[model samples]
Target: MCHTSGVSSERAAHLLRLSALFQAAPAADVQALAELARLRTLRRGDVLFHQGDAATHLYVVESGWLKVSKLAAHGQREVVLHLSGPRQMVSGVSVFVDNARYSASAAALEDAGVLTLSAEAVRHQTAQSPALAQAVIAHFAKRHVELLERFDDLLFSDLNARLARLLLEHAPPGTTLLLPTNSELAAHLNTVPELVSRKLGEFYRQGFISLERRTVRIVDEAALRSLGGP
Candidate 1:
C-alpha cells in the first residue's frame, strides 16, 4: 500500500480533490496518499470483497454504483447496508479495525471505476493527519446512526408504510423500478418474500400499483403517499 505508482503529482492532487474523503487533507498528505493508490474497473455484479475478507483496500467509487451488503446467519439471506454512488467511499473503517476484516461485502451495482488505496498506506496517512483520522471516525459514526435509523424504521413502521415510502422515493408513475427484486425488498424491509408478494398484490387490488416482470408501475401516487404514514 505504501508503494508508489510514480504518478504525476498534478494528477495525484486532482484525484485527491475529486475524493470527498481526501479533499480536505493537507497538500503534502494528498500527494503522498494518491501515490499509494491504483485504479480498478468493475463490471456490473462484480464483487469487490466478501464478509470476513481481508480489508486490504479502501475503495473510492469514481463512477457508477456499488452496493454494500451482509449475509444472515448460516448465509440464509442477505441484506443491503447501502447503495453507494459516485464519489462515495466504501469501507473507510476497514482500514482501522484491529482484525482488518470487512464486516460486509461490496459489489458493483453497475459498471464502475474505483481508486483502490492500500489500507496500510491510509492508516499511515491517518497516523500523520489528524484530519484524516477525524474524517474516518466521522464516517463510522454516521453509518452507526444510519443503521439505527433503519432499525427504527423496521421496528416502528408498518410494511405498507415502508413499501409506500420506497415506491415514492424510487419508483414513481411512468418510471420502471430497477433491479431490486421482491427478495431484496423483503430483506430490506425485514419481512418475508411471501409477505412482500402479498402486499404488492394488495397494492394492485387497491389500484395503487401495477406490476410486470421485474418492474412496478406507480399508478396512484397520492394514495401511496397516504399509505406511507408518518
Candidate 2:
C-alpha cells in the first residue's frame, strides 16, 4: 500500500460526486471532504484491510477492482461478498456505524487506486449537514434492497443456474470474456473449484460455452439464458 498527496481537489470532488452516498451532498461539505481525502495505491492481491479491523477510514475506488470477502465460521473457507470497481465504495457505509469494524476483508483484484477519508471527519461533517445524513439513509435503503435480491437468488437458485447467470453477466453471445480464476469464481459462487471446473466442462460439452485459459466464449446464448432463467 502507498499513499500519495497528489489527488487534486477537483479529482477528489469528482470521485466523491460519483458515489451515490455523496452525490447529493452540500457543496461545502463536499469541498471539506475533498480536502481531507488522500489517494492510496494497491498492488494486485494486496490486502487493503482485514476483517475485524478498526473502521477508521472509508475507501472509494478510483480505478481497478477490489474484492470484499469474509471467512467462514470454521475458518477453513472464505466467501466473496462483493467486487467493487471504479466509482464504487468499499467501506463507506460501515464507517458511519458507532464502534464499527470492517465486516469483511478487502483486497485488490488488480492494481488499483483508491481514495481514503477519515471516518471521524465524515461523522463530524454528517453531524453538521442534514443533507449528508439524508444521502446516507438513501444509500442504506438501496443497499438493503440489493441484499434482499441476492438472498433470494442464493436461496432459490441452484449452482448451475447461478454459474450460468454469472457467465451471461460477463459475456454476451459469441463474445469472449476474461474471468477471474476458478478458485475465485468458486469463492464468489459459494462452491468448490472442482465443481466450478466440472460445470464449465459440462457447459462445454453441451455447446453452451468454450473455455480457453481464463477466458470463456459463449457458444449458445439461448441455452444458457434458458438454464439461467429470469
Candidate 3:
C-alpha cells in the first residue's frame, strides 16, 4: 500500500536542499514549491505510477530505491531503464514537459519514501524563477545525455562487455556487494535471465569474479576492465 500526506515546508525544503537539482535554486523559490510538497510512502513492489499516467506531480526520492521502466507496446515486455535512489528524481523529468504523460513507470525497489510536488504548482513557480528554470533545464539535459549513453551501450556493446561493466560499477575490485537478482540484472541489461545466469557462470569459471550466492567480490579487476573497456 502507498500512503500520502502533506509535509512541512521546512522539511520539504530540506529535502530539496539535499538534491543537486535544487542546490542552486533561490531560497524563496525552493520554499514556494516546498509549501506544496507532499510525502508518499511505498512498500516494496508498490507501483508509484503507471506509464501513460498524467504527470501531475514530480517526485524526489527521500529513502530507498525505485526502478523506472517502460513496458513494451504489446505489454509483453519490460525494460528497466534506471534505478533511482535517495535525492534523485523519480519520474520527475517528465513533469517539466507540457502535456506530457509518464513515459515509464516507477515502482519501489524496497520500502521507500518520496517527496511529491504538484506539477502545476512547480510550473507556476518556475515561470517566475529564472534560477529554478535554469536548474531544471540542466537536469533535463543531464538525463538526455544519460539516455543517449544507455542507447549507445545497448546498440554497440556486447553482453559480456555490458555485464562486466555493470558488475564493476556496483562492486569494484576488493569490495563485496550484494547484487540484484539475475532477473533484475537481465531487465537492466535488456536480456533474458537465462543468459544472465549463463554469463555470470562463465565469469565465475574464468575466475574473473567470486560469487557467493548473490554477493560478488572481484578477483581479477584488470581482466574485467579490459573486457568492459573504458
Query: Per-residue lDDT for 1-230 in model 2, tens only?
Result: 65455688889999999987788888889999998899999988888899999998998999877888998897888888877777888987778987899989999877889999989999999999898889888888999998898788878899899899878865667566556667878888878899998999999999999888767899999999999998
- Model 2: pairs clashing at backbone N, Cα or C within 3 Å: none
Off by over 4 Å in 2: 164-178, 198-212, 215-230
In candidate 1, which residue pairs clash?
Answer: none
> In candidate 3, which residue ranges exceed 4 Å CA deviation?
167-181, 199-228
Question: Would you list the rank order by lDDT, best first?
Answer: 3, 2, 1
Error of 3 at 214 (Å): 5.4
Q: Which structure is stronger by lDDT: 2 or 3?
A: 3
Query: Residue-wise lDDT of candidate 1 within 92-113, one digit each (tens)?
Result: 8787765589999988766777
lDDT of each: 0.77, 0.85, 0.86
Predicted structure 3: lDDT? 0.86
Q: What are the clash counts of all predictions, listed in order?
A: 0, 0, 0
Candidate order, TM-score descending: 2, 3, 1
